[model samples]
Target: MPHTGHHLRAVFRRPDFRRLLSARLTFQGADGVFQAGLTGTILFNPDRQTSAMAIALGFAVLLLPYSLIGPFAGVLLDRWSRRNVLIIANIVRAAVVPAVAAMIWVGIAAEAFLPLVLIVVGGTRLVSAAVSAALPHVVDEKELVTANSFISTAGGLAYAVGIAAAMGLRPLFGASDHGYAIIALMSVLGYVGTALVIRKFTPNELGPDDVPDSGGVSVARLAWHELRTGAQHLAARKNAAGALLVVVGMRVFFGAALIAVVLLYRNYFTADGFFRTHETGLGQIMFASAAGNLIAAGITPAATRLFGTRQWLGMLLPLAAAAQLGLGILFTMPGLIAASFLVAIASQGARLVAETTLQTECADEYRGRVFSVFDTLFNACLVLGLVAGAAFLPETGKSYAALIVISVGYGLLAAGYLWLSRGSTLPVMPAKPKTEPAQALTQLR
Candidate 1:
């Protein structure tokens, strides 16, 4: 609790951290613009026929493979220059996204759409992994908690700004493939800006041991071996591992809720002028959720301090569960939107605690790989939730059964967390003593 204020200000003062934050904000803001356009065009459009399974497939296409790919590719972050990865990945994305946007504008087949979306989405995930891995390089470990909070919150707000921009422009441009192409094209340029921003950092600022070479097996074997090593490191840290599981649980619950909300807004809500259309209504709900996410970052540290990190996380999980079921009971317009805000806060708050815990508890050497594993779990669970919603939700998106399942699932997560940490009062890990970034970079070269 003490010095938290000073530390928050101190985080903003670091020049390199500011550059890193700029990279993240620019990239994520572009992502928001791209996503908002896509959702408006494909998912929420009243003119287009959409289905639950179709929605599931669309989401799974963007997310699920990255789950498989993150850890395997994380070996790159550890072994290669992460700054280069950031630069190259964003550049590649800048090239690829316009192609994807073109396909959307031309009304490509579903099969074609998925593959292109995969390339762009996969690149985005890599950029995100690189940022998380490189984060400790710019800021002191003492500031890691607040730094992560500020960085993530700023990223979310940037994303919301992007979404708002899409909303504002859609009327002028029309919510069609042309509009999607235009918005996504702009994001491509934003990705290039992100590339230039990361250029401020040196090649080796991010990390892996600076061994000159490796006596190795095949590349796949090497990647598998490295992933296993990361798993072992994560396995050794019980509380960090537990926290990750909790975050994954949150993703699953919200993933299902997301699909449900999309369907609910699309079909069940009266389009007879109360909100004008489902897209407008859903956009507002998402905006509220985004605001809650931004707000959560500010509150998480204090909440964790008042109730220990593990305890605070334990409380948030059930609150999320209650929010889900409460929405089930209310099952009305204002109710759904308001409940979404509450659920968003709990989920985002819980997620921040997990990120801070993993970043702090894991050693620097293994940080990238651990984050990869966490992201993998996160994507997989989210895909699973989306698929589950597809299975349970009707065309109307009103499924009491699905809500019950989501609530029970979150309840199990809450109970599981409290049960695991029942007797032991585990302490949070502070930043480890380390060489300065300049010295680390010197050694790296």
Candidate 2:
């Protein structure tokens, strides 16, 4: 059974993929819609700058707690059933949404933004971490690329739809007290759907590592051992380390660059400028990026095959760096907007394929902890970038010289990763249980 293009298409047609896709799209889309409403409602209010900052502070507060706890959650995922975790996580989200809604309705949102948003953001990130870490347990490694591609496509759809809906619903709802409530309802529905679909999914049973450590080891000692073990496992794998470094470094630059883009957009376009007039420019950009994601999803299998290991990673990293550079240069050019959009598509598409493939290669027992490490570092770098970018915020007119300089730094790092790993083979993990059909089918049965 070789994976011809016909076979690939049939792979996409699998019932599991469809259900998972639905769950991803719904969860991501609901997130998008909710954020849209939240940001739209807050930004539209003239007296909310301080409140907005408070909300941001809430995000910062949640960041460390979320990141620090993720690895342990991953350990739990390894030991416990992923299906149950996903279902429970969604239920938790559903419960939180209405609480947020109530706060908004009572005019306490601006006052209690910190605590409320902290709980929401932290909880959401933890759930997402658990679900993502658990993906390899559901799909076979042979199907990893295909499964992740579908996930990225669904994410793209969610991003585009969420932005558009947010923009449209703002005017419809008048960005009033009820706006947040509507978003909460959407989140509730999405969570419910996610929980339902998860119920139908049969996850791979936990291996011995998934069992809770009960040999009289204290929780603190277990946590320390798990962290150390996870780190050792990842560090020992040269290929995984290389891929992780590239992603981690790129996220640092990307996080800063993203914040820079936001500031630049606010300065250059604002709600009163191009976006307010057309209203669709943001969506256009998002849709263009989504199109790129879709294209990436379609071509990823072939690209992964043709590019192999080093070449594929090489091409994507530099391509992403170049895209960021292009964005820096064309930050304000309306004509270059489409190019900018495509650049985002290319970067995100490539990263999704490359990163997930790398993560899926790790052993399942260590997978959660390893992924949590990636998530923690990636997120920490992002926050660092945002903070750094804020320092570089232009006080005057439109000048992207600073961004151009930063992009160059990122480009060099990307090139360095390629150079460092030059002699390496594709590093494709050939030890998957599926390769042993007798064992694989036995597990399936």
Which residue pairs clash in candidate 2? Answer: 78-210, 79-210
Worst 10 residues of 1 by lDDT: 436-445
lDDT of 1 by residue, 322-390 (tens): 887886657787777778788878887877777766666566666677778778888888888899888
Candidate 2 whole-model C-alpha lDDT, 0 to 1: 0.60
Per-residue accuracy of model 2 over 149-260 as CA lDDT, tens digit each? 6676776688578667777776666556676557645667877888898788765532323465559987667867888988887666665577666766766666566555
The prediction achieving the highest lDDT against the true structure is: 1
Give TM-scores for every candidate, taking all chains together and pairing residue i with residue i: 0.92, 0.85
Q: Residue 106 error for model 1, in Å? A: 1.8
Stretches of model 1 off by over 4 angstroms after superposition: 209-212, 271-276, 429-445
Separately for all candidates shown, the number of backbone clashes (residues 3 or more apart, or on different chains) is 0, 2
lDDT of predicted model 1: 0.76
